[model samples]
Target chain A: MYRLKATFIKEFKLLSVDKTGITILFIMPVFLVFIMTLIQQQAYKSMSQSGVPVLLVNRDRDSLGTAVERGFSNFPVAQLTVDHGERYPNEDAIRKEITNGKYTVALYIPANATKILEQNVEEIMGRMFNKGQIANNTKVDIGIIIDPTANKPMVIAITSRLKQYLADVKTGVLFNIMGSKIAGMMHAEIKGGMPQEDIFSYKENYAFRDNRSSYQPDAVQHNIPAWAIFSIFFIVLPLGGGIINERSEGLFIRMRTLPGSYLSLLSGKLLAYFFIALIQFLLVILLGVYVLPLVGLPVLHIGSNIVPLVLLTVVLALAAVGYGLFIGTLFDTPQQSAVFGGISVLIMSALGGIWVPMNIMPEVMQKISSCSPLNWALRGYYELFIKGGGWPAIQTEVIKLSVFFIVCLAISYRIFQHKTNTN
Target chain B: MEGKACIKVRELSKQYKGSSYLAVNKLSFEIYEGEIFGLLGPNGAGKSTFLSMLSGLIKPTSGEAEIFDHKLTTDTELLKRIIGVVPQDIALYPTLSGRDNLLFIGRMYGLSEKELKDTVDKYLNRFGFEKNGSNAVKTYSGGMKRRINLIGGMLHNPKILLLDEPTVGMDVQARTSTMEFLNEVNEQTKMTIIYTSHDMEQANTFCDRVGIIDRGQILKLGTPDGLPASEGCKDLETLFLKLTGRKIRD
Candidate 1:
């Protein structure tokens, strides 16, 4: 343990003197989180207010087409721009407009839309009033054109809202057609002898409930943990580079003469780097909770599960330090280690959904992301910040990160032993 | 006059994995207590390799070596505690101050905090760098770094000291000061020193006995004046050239 302390002190002192390394380890993460959160916040607000640029082509001159136009116009989240003409534009022209960036999305309501909806309503009334015999001969197909160049999230959001609006319109038409028939039946029953008080007491209420405390999307909740995990993984550059430099400079050979095992030396480095990782994690959290709020960004909350949050951060640091040691031991020169470490961290972070949320990614990519250690840490953070989950929610991810730490440390120790023995 | 053998090598040999040539082959020698022995050779002649094996940095392929009766292979931890190794290259952290570097190494050697502090301060004062000891090693001159490197090894005050080209790249003044300090430490402390060097003049003047080595084997071993007389040469350099040949090794 004393040997480990010495090693830790030595590594800590060495790293502390390196101004650039210190800045990257602490300052860079805070800066990235602050800037990214502010930028994403602005984007969310703009996206909500500006609304998706939608071009509506109405071919039906009846109430259904007008209803469709009015539905988009009344929707608070979409900008409804109607093209008034006798004929609807061709599919090719709509596609061209989308490609030209004139609009992000386009909706075409066909001439038979009103007729089809009316027929559906009539069939529904026949089923309810007559003995369940009805004819439905019309199919309602609304063509939606989306700009391929637009971001995936924008395209998905607009398409979802359009589908929801159309469904609501269909439901309203069905209700309108069924109301009068049900009223006539009620009137006949009342004359025979029914209570008017019961009819007036009929009430149905609708509300929204979430699994978590609340369902609000805020940038700080996402960016703080994501960038913090990214910064932790980046410990590879300085830690790995330092290891390579020590080997090349003959410090390892000199160190071998000391009365301690190689494990002690490695343990010392692990202890030091882990402390650094923890500090980085806390700084990012502090920035989100206190500093960013002052700048008008939403405050980040760690929910009620402090245990899992702390456990996950420590395990993540260990995993990152182990990875740094492996890279340091594998490479022969500082430059080699630097390039490999830098590029590998960036690639892993990107794959792990640090740059974009995993929910927005394709299914195949989401599956592949599970292999990244960064993904494990990010998932645990999301459970704490977004899901407001306690220990039961984040236990699996914490165990996985711990396993990653052990595996990486084992491999690194073996390589270090081989190199020192051969040296 | 020689004392008891501090180090003994019995046909020690090392052939690196996947390499055809032996770096050190069937070499046998002994250095007595309180003696300064020098291993002289050209580059790649296995001088550093032999020193590394003695320092317990690498394992020999065959035979065995014992330092102070501790086997180099089996009793490595014990041997490490008794031997001080100053490598060929500057091994101290460039970012750490000289004092911190010394104290850190001393702790690794199992010295108590108070002991380490006193030892570091004593060495710094003796080396005439007491005032500048707080400065980082990267800011130090070549001579200052060399002094700190030497001090780092001796902090534990081991019985056997192994130095590999300790004064290779220093200026004349630095080299002279380093040699003077080494001689003083040898005479005052009676520590057994095994040094390797390509500098014939330094070895000739500084070493009590010198061995000429080439091609993984020792060609000649004796007092400096005695080895040259046997080769019919006036100096150690001429004797080395005569035995190792004139070809330059890469």
Candidate 2:
């Protein structure tokens, strides 16, 4: 028992100074969860989820700005709040409204934006007609400030709509320039600026394919648990490397000579790394519950039946640690452990529907996904999180993860015995 | 060399899996208490294998070895408590300071905190590591790392020390200092040591008895000077060359 404590202390000391390992364990999961949730929120947007509240801060009171105003007024996907800078004085008020979920996006058109766009467009027309016009360089940067918590599809929809309006106006001006030029060459008198034609605007039509009303695209519900599981499994990297180092550096030989069971020495590392894995899960879950709501996303709804959730996380972490130890003991070098362990984890993550939810996958692929431990883990969390389940619903996954943990440790110990502990 | 037998071996043979020859052939020897014994050999002469069996790191295939009548096969727990192993490799953790490494190894052998700290400090001072003891072993030079590795085995001060080329990579000054420190420990504590080395010059003055080994068997067993005198060679090096032949092992 004392020996085990000593080993644990030694491992903890080694880990404390390992800056790279600590960053990989903690920061990587947070980044993954945050980025994946923000980006994939668009996948949840449907026709029923349209008409997002939008604020237009138009300081450019010219032709281009009026075009933007007309575009937003007719925008099919937005509830346009056209303002004359009275209700909201500056960008900060718009940002406050966005954080409070009143508006999903704010369009800021800077002063003189119209003049720059018109000049650049005229230069483009001059270049097209081969008129020896003096070169002019000007740029128009229309700012789009989005709610950080807004889903990706919403931002893409708004930005692309604004871009189409600008392109249409540019084309209209180019055609008017061409008409005036042709009239001048033929020496014909033009009436009312080449008689501008009314161009019909085209709009995008979304096709609604499925009526799966049961599934809601909740960013916090999906990403927090998915990425948490992934980050937990990533514990394999450092743990496997630790095993290889012990074997190759003769630490195992010296350890075998010590008056203690191999399990005790093994426990020291598992306990330390297991703490890291648990902290990772907790951090991610906290971010989901608190941080998600501030950005106008749904807060993660982990029900009051907290025991099952904690139970599943512990078992998942155990499976990850066991897997790490098995990879370390089976391989001879850090390179072998890293390459094989890393590739296997990523493959498991893909098959487990970590990249895409298993429900949308082909039935055949979904069946194969059941073979991945990550899939089992993810399914367990989804049961408690999405289906409002408790111990009875998640028990099977718990048992499966427990079995995986046991088998890995057993095989690792057997390998260790065969390779080094001949006595 | 006159003392009670601390370790006894009889027909100890170890034929590794898928190998044509025994790594440590059927042989018999006794390592007495309070003496330094050297198993001098070339690269593959099974000196390491022999020390491994004595330390209970590996099992003998067809024979028995005992420490004071405690059998290696049936009594490993007791044997592990009685022996210290210094492997050819630097077995200490690289990221840990030398003092921490010693304290951790000492704890593994069931030593108390006070004993561990005091013994670690004494050995660190003795081995010329008074200043570098608090630094990580990774930052140390090769000779310095080897010193820490050697100290790791002796932290608990076991009854027998099994050293496998403990001074292989040390410089002249480091090697001499290490040998002198080890000799001082042996004189003051009466700890029996089984040291293995390929260099005859190293084991000549250090070991009280030298056993020239080749092909997993000991060819000559006597005092270093007596064995060379019997072979009519100038030293253990020439005598080993004459017995094992002039061919290089590796």
Candidate 3:
């Protein structure tokens, strides 16, 4: 055990001294977080500012109507004017202006609009009386046309609301003038009851604003944490290879001759790798919380959600280290371990939902992914971020990860035992 | 073999599981205390396999080796402490400085920090590695690296040191310097040194006694001077060539 401890310390020093190892451990992940934060910030800004650009043309000579149209102003829907002289512009000219993209909407109200309103009111009142409903409500239609260039959803929402408002106004006018009194007289004469009050309330709700033009898009919940977990996973490759390297180099023999056991040596290596992994996790989480929000990206709830994510992730990391050790013992060369080891980790990580979310995957794929420990890890993070979860929600994932650690460690020990007997 | 010595082997043999032949067939040898011994043979003479058995690196198909009055097959941990084997390969980490490698080796031997530091510096300076000790082993020449490999084994100053082809690929200056340094340490410490080499001349010059092993058997064993005198041959090399007939290569 003492000899093994010495081997562990030695191996750690070797890893620290290697320039490539140090960079992989400390520099790469930090740099990646920085770049990701910058991109996310820009995306959020653009999303917030994204708006449709529209133009308006009014050929109507009515001054009151023109003033009503002028009252509505927004950046997405801009009103551009085309003047007509006393003779008035031809309909063909108006169409030509609209077709050339000078205006998004065109309006024209005829000069005899007062006469039309009088005739339509009388005609509509006679039809309402025939149907046994109240009558003589004013009806008006200022001719309006929409450009094809306008967004379909925006046009639909606007047109539908306008029609509904017009219908409501007609009803309101009738009730204010005569319909309410008529109903009251009937109620006094027979039923001895009044009409019930109808409460009407309307408000608009937006989940996320269209602020894209001003800031970058926020990183969706899974991307950063999943990427962070995978970065921790990659640590296993180098650390496992370090053990194989020492064994092949006769360092173990030197160690055995010393005063320690194999267990102590392996523990020391696990300690070093675990701490390095912890540092990596902190750097990524800290950057996600502090640095990501600077350029318009909202920070993830790290203070509240990071603890369970880290606890489970650390357990997974330890399992991965053991898996690496298993491969190291099985393979003769570091290169062999690296190639097979990397591919296996990737496959398991993919199955575990590190590369992709397991929820959207096919049933069979989900089942297969569930077999991987990473699947539970990502799901735990997803719960924290998406499901508003706390410790209780992630307990299952932690337990699953713990099981994986135990199983992989047992297998690793078995392989080590077998190899030690022969080599 | 007749006496129960510090180390003993009887009808010891090993056949690599997948191979068609035996590496060491019914091999046998013995060594006593307070002696500098050499396992001398040409390439492929099973010198390595022989030493490997004593070090307990691999299990014999049907044989046994004991070290320091303990059976190697049973008391592995105790055997490990009693023997230190410097492999034929350069096993030190290339990325680590010489001192760090020594400290690491010292730790494996269960030495404390101060003790390790003292032992590391003592060996580093003794081996003339003062200026280059701080540099990574990768930057050092072949000889310097080999010396470090040798030092790593002896950091705990084990009672026994086994070196396999220690000077196989070094230049003249490095070869002489390393051998002389080892000789001085061996003489002063009175530690048993079991070294294997193809250089009959160096072995003849340095070893207290030598064994000419061929086909996993000790063909001859005597002091460097006595072997030739008994055989009535010219020198150690001539006797070696005569004992093991020359072929182009094995």
Ten consecutive residues with minimal summed lDDT in candidate 2 chain A? A205-214
Which candidate ranks first by TM-score, i.e. highest?
Answer: 1
Runs off by more than 4 Å, candidate 2:
A41-217, A290-298, A417-423
- Which residue window of length 10 is worst by lDDT in model 3 chain B? B1-10
**Could you tell me how far off, in angstroms, the CA of residue B190 lies in candidate 1 after the best superposition?**
1.1
Give the Å shift of residue A300 in candidate 2.
Answer: 3.6
Query: For model 2, what is the alpha-carbon lDDT of residue A387?
Result: 68
* Ordering by TM-score: 1, 3, 2
> What are the per-model DockQ values?
0.69, 0.40, 0.46
lDDT of each: 0.84, 0.84, 0.69
TM-score of 1: 0.85
Candidate 1 chain B lowest-lDDT run of ten: B1-10
Backbone-clash count (model 2): 1
True contacts kept of each: 0.85, 0.72, 0.58
lDDT string for model 3 (A7-81, tens) is 557666876787888787777777766665566555444433543223333333343234334433432333334
Pairs in steric clash, model 2: A42-A153
**lDDT (0-100) at residue B166 of candidate 1?**
91
Expressed as tens digits, the lDDT of each residue in A1-423 for candidate 2 is 788788878887887777887788888888888878877665454422567788988888876778888988888777788775777767888778888989898887777776777678778777777866648786787768898877677678888999887776666666566667778889876666423455678865432123223444466787788888988898999999997888777787788788876668878889888887899999999888898778777888776669999999999999999999999989999999999999999999999989878987899999999999999999998887776778988999999999999999899889987876443
**CAPRI accuracy category, model 3:** acceptable
